[model samples]
Target chain A: MKNIKVLGSGCANCKATFARIEKVARAKGVAVTLEKVEDFAQIAAYGVMSTPGVVIDGKVVHAGGIPEQQQIESWL
Target chain B: MFEQFAHFLVYQLGGLSPASQLGTALHFWVMDTTKILVMLVVVIYFMGLFRTWLSPEKVRRVIQGRSKTLARILAVTLGAMTPFCSCSSVPLFIGFVEAGIPLGITFSFLIASPMINEVAVVLLIGLIGWQLTVLYITAGLTVAYVGGIAMERFHPEKWVEAYVWQIQMGEIAQPAIDTSLRGRHVFAVSQVTEIVGRIWLWVLIGISAGALFHGYVPQTWVAGLSERENWLAVPMAVMLGIPLYSNAVGVIPLAEAMLAKGVALGTTLALMMSIAAISLPELLILRKVMRVPGLLLFVAVLMVAITLVGWLFNLLN
Candidate 1:
């Protein structure tokens, strides 16, 4: 089971990443729930200072950039 | 000898006021000086805590994700939330790729983290009110989003060192550690001290300069010479800011004073952002991580993008 956090201001990159994640998840039949973290305070709690961040389980796995599709699938 | 004498006379004639000038200078100095001292301790405290809870390597190792786009979006959103100052950015940048963060996505995070912060937002809300504050937030976030995508498109692989792209071995083997309340308190004080120590001077300079411009300079000068009329204000301001560094937290107070003197919101913001993001200080720091060409490209793109943002904001208002 994977819990996904797509952290960013609702912008093109944020939306694009969510779309890509969903695409890969659906294709791979992975069990995952995507949560959108928009509040600035909550994002800080995770110690992330960049947008479009990804958190899996309890740890922040990505903060500055987007990872590739295959990588997401593998993580799932 | 003639030029020296002429300059001496100009200084004497520009006399404006003694008490008011000193008072204004003091007022600006105290306000910004306080921020510097506080931020210094805060940043250093965070550093100690950072070291305790997250190893440099462990911190690097943490942010590895699946989808590139999702990661980028998260980075921007996260950037907005955490409100990173310039100081925190360096170590984090070093640790990020070591943790397996991607380049294009990292760019998004880097752009957003410092641009849209809580301190900036609060200051904006208080000084300019909520509407413009929202506008600023929207514009800042959008830049991170679009600018990030643009960077991805151009793919400046040359800018990144070969080693920076690959994951570096971290302190994964270290024993589990926990930081307590007393330790946290000490860390916070130190952070305040460190950040304040360095930036106090900047705060003073920013405010006094702003106050002088506020009280003395003709308000018509800024309003009259706007881009719609002069065209050069935008680029000139941008160029000026690129080589200078100023914090939004510190700059906003000055900006408020400037607006009081008839300076338009757009021009003030443009100059502020330029000083914060593309300034020489930030650029020089970037040089450590990026080659000259890569640095230039980043500066060029960011400068053009922020200027347009400032312009659109003025138009809307």
Candidate 2:
């Protein structure tokens, strides 16, 4: 199963990425699992320095800021 | 004759109960006001002082390489002294790694940066008494020291990205600001207002949370779980703390609130420090520099050590 992580503090940017990811995922009919990681330690494990990050299946796809929906879709 | 004198004095000074009440109120007011005022002064003074002494490049140079016992100590002590924010945590990592510092010693720097900020320390003293103030500082410094040393022993250098090594080395210049005695005072006041004023909200939040725990959370409940032997509470606190990014500012308000609510001082403080210091956000940020294994080890060591510290304080106090 594809696992997606939207790592953020529920900020607008973080939510936006989640919405975008959800939109992109829904369009593709991907049954990927999504989770929000807010913990500092877990986030460090991913090695990302910025919020509004995206991790697909365990790879950090975006960091510090939100990437475009298309970029996220590519990873999915 | 003495009895008569006592009676006359009591009559002159108003009723004994009223006099006693006045004395108690005065005592509390003096204590509260002084701690707040003096702590503000001291934090301001320290901030300005660092404007002269501390630098990231210097920190890198001091802690780098094999002879690291000294470096770890300096990193924690000095790391606590600096006023950088979570955003700056990344830049500092780049600076330290480039300076040839060991992974563990740099961890010391990272933990201390936010956990023991001056604002948190001073505000702590202001709200709580001096004993806890000293205890927090000592515990933070000790954890950084011991934790860093452990990391170095079982060292993992593979975690860092090769890109950090590619960045050009730049010298850390001394602080740009300087002033006379009067200028220092003015600088101190301005720094107080600037730094403290900015984070007052955070302080309120942290203290409030703490106060809530203090007031509502039963000591037996925390004591049951937070004891050295307890399996659930320590990990839960650390796990809960990991994701949250509560700055010193946000934390202080919660602390105050917890204390007001009768929360166990040690337990709330332990959880609070964990959030502010060993936060998952910081770990995630650090992972960019360190591998997953290294990051996990760091977090594990910190969790155990801080939980132990919390347990010990609870027992002693």
Candidate 3:
């Protein structure tokens, strides 16, 4: 199981990123607890200044934008 | 090569007279769209890489407990680099307060983060000349810095919500990252793609307005408004801009349009900055943390500063 967190301020891109993660997790049959960290403090804690950041198990694997499914799956 | 291609593509296809409004509009549209889009990609890529090197923790440490003078400047610079949106405003505001960053310093950061936009920079450079671009940047930074300093001097800390001062968070530790050449390059590429992709439509809309203004507006009409009597245009533009909401990218073309239709550069920029700095939505969001008086003060300070910049620029020109 992986704890995957998506960071954004509910902007369009942020919402899309959240949707994409849910879809990808379901397709892979990955046992994951997905969380959306909308709080800027928590998001800034990961040192990801831009939106739609991805964090897996407390480690930020992506920031500033969305990543490919393959890359996201790899992180998971 | 690019210029010739744009000319051939726009002018050759229509087979219309270059002097005609339609032909001129098409030509302006193509030329501006291409230049702005190319600049947006390249500048965003580089800015993303530059952003990766900066962290909120680093910014916190720089200004934490510093004197008002130093913190004001640092806050403006950091705010310019960080792409902060309204959604993140609450948390960032709380975090800054918790970190013992001064109220005024935080205000500077908040003001600059929205006011100094990279998209605005690229579009300004592409549509207008670099001279005005530099002027806008300098004026923006100065306004942010001075407004913050004034806020600090006035000591409006009492107006902040009580809960803000009460929330306690432990020291934020510095984040460790694997700084490799490849990592930065990838980050930069992703940033360019995401930012450019999202804003391409707004850019198109902006250039379209500019195209119409360029093709149809008369020079004498514009010149008439440029005279000193039209100084009222600055305040009028600011007044009109505050109620509307749009990002810097969406407003650039409108600024160009206004400029084309007989508005002064300073007045046009004042309108754009007001849209960013004193936006109603942004103010409403900040109201969550600040009482009405503080919010009013913030808006007043910005209004005065931006107006001053507009008038100064008008005078200098």
Candidate 4:
């Protein structure tokens, strides 16, 4: 199972990103533990200045805006 | 060409007489909506392509240790160019501080990022003209510059959250964006999609409100407010705009309508700047990283600067 974390302060874009990632993972039948990180310090610790950042298994995969469906699929 | 198209669509096709108020308002709405939307897509796409190279990380690195004057200039410029989302302000603020950027410089970025943006610029040029656009940009940058200096005077470093100073930022591998021609095209396309998706409703609402004002609001009432004797207009406009909490995109069309209705330029400009720059939600977010005093000072500085800009423009006009 992949550990996927969405980092944001619960903005609309972040919520949308979380939902999209989950939907894509489920559709791909990929088992993943999804977590939402809303803490600003934690987000900055990863050096991700933009919100709705995606972290896959401790690696920063995306930052700033929602990831595309195809990109999410490739991650899965 | 847009005017002709709107004329054809409203009068020729819809069979609405141009003499009627509803018809005139509908024509204005259609023309402005189409014109502004086209301009937005093109301008935003190009801007996105250019902005793909800029990130907060890079901005932090550049401004980290520059001289005060040089840093302030760069901060405001990059702040205007950077495609920033207010939701990310907290992390961005922490990142800048962790990178050892000055508090004043950070405030400069915060002010310019929202107050002067591509959407506002493009819409201003489309709805109004280049002269006002130039004035708006100049005023925004000046406010940002002066505001930064004033913030630094307070020595606001002490007012930052204690935890923010303690947190050490770690280097993380950033996802590399595709930088080829095709990649830029894709990025720009996505930018257009995302931006238009987010703001289309607001644009429509703005244009509709503008249409109503244009069609129905009497010029004499607007004149009363615009009169030089009415010294309260600018401050009143600034105060009235605080609760609106809108970005520049939604306010420009309404501004255009107000200008057309003979409202004073300064009052309209004040309203636009206040709505774009100060908002309750953004303030609440900033509260996480700044103590109450720092936050209050920040707001006070912005309020005074914006009010001064309003009055200066009013005096000049």
Using lDDT, rank the candidates from best to worst.
4, 3, 2, 1
Candidate 4 all-Cα RMSD: 2.1
Which one is best on DockQ? Answer: 4
lDDT of 3: 0.79
lDDT of 3 by residue, B1-317 (tens): 55776679877866767777887788778888888888888888888788668766567778888877788888999898777777657656776787788888898998898888788899888887899899888988988998888788778898988876766645443433336977788777878888888888888887887777778778888787655458788888788888878877777878777777666778888998999888887787677778999988888888888899899988887
lDDT of 4 by residue, B1-317 (tens): 89999999999999999999999999998998999899999999999888677777778888988998898899999999987778989988998888788899999999999999898898788667789999999999988999999999999999898999988878843535677988878888999998989888878887787788878888788787555546688888988888898888888877877787678888889899999998889999999999889988998898889999999998898
Q: List where candidate 1 sits over 4 angstroms from the true fold.
A: A1-76, B1-63, B81-91, B118-126, B172-178, B189-232
Kindly provide the TM-score of model 2 when superposed on the true structure, using C-alpha atoms: 0.63
Give the per-residue lDDT of model 2 (tens digit) for B119-220: 777787767767878887887787777777777777667666666666653433222223466655655665766666666555544444443454355567
Ranking by TM-score: 4, 3, 2, 1
Ten-residue stretch with the least lDDT total in model 3 chain A: A41-50
> What lDDT score is found at residue B174 in candidate 4?
54
**Per-model CA lDDT versus the true structure:** 0.61, 0.65, 0.79, 0.88
Model 1 lDDT tens row, B1-317: 33333233333454424356554444444444454445445444665565455432343343466577776777777666554534334435645655667766667767776677655665566446678788777877777777777776777767765544453434322312325877556544544554556555655565556546644666577666443534456667778776566666666766666566555677667776776666565555556556888777777778888888877766765
The numbered model that scores best in TM-score is 4
RMSD of 3: 3.2
Docking class of 3: acceptable
Question: lDDT score, residue B141, model 2?
Answer: 82
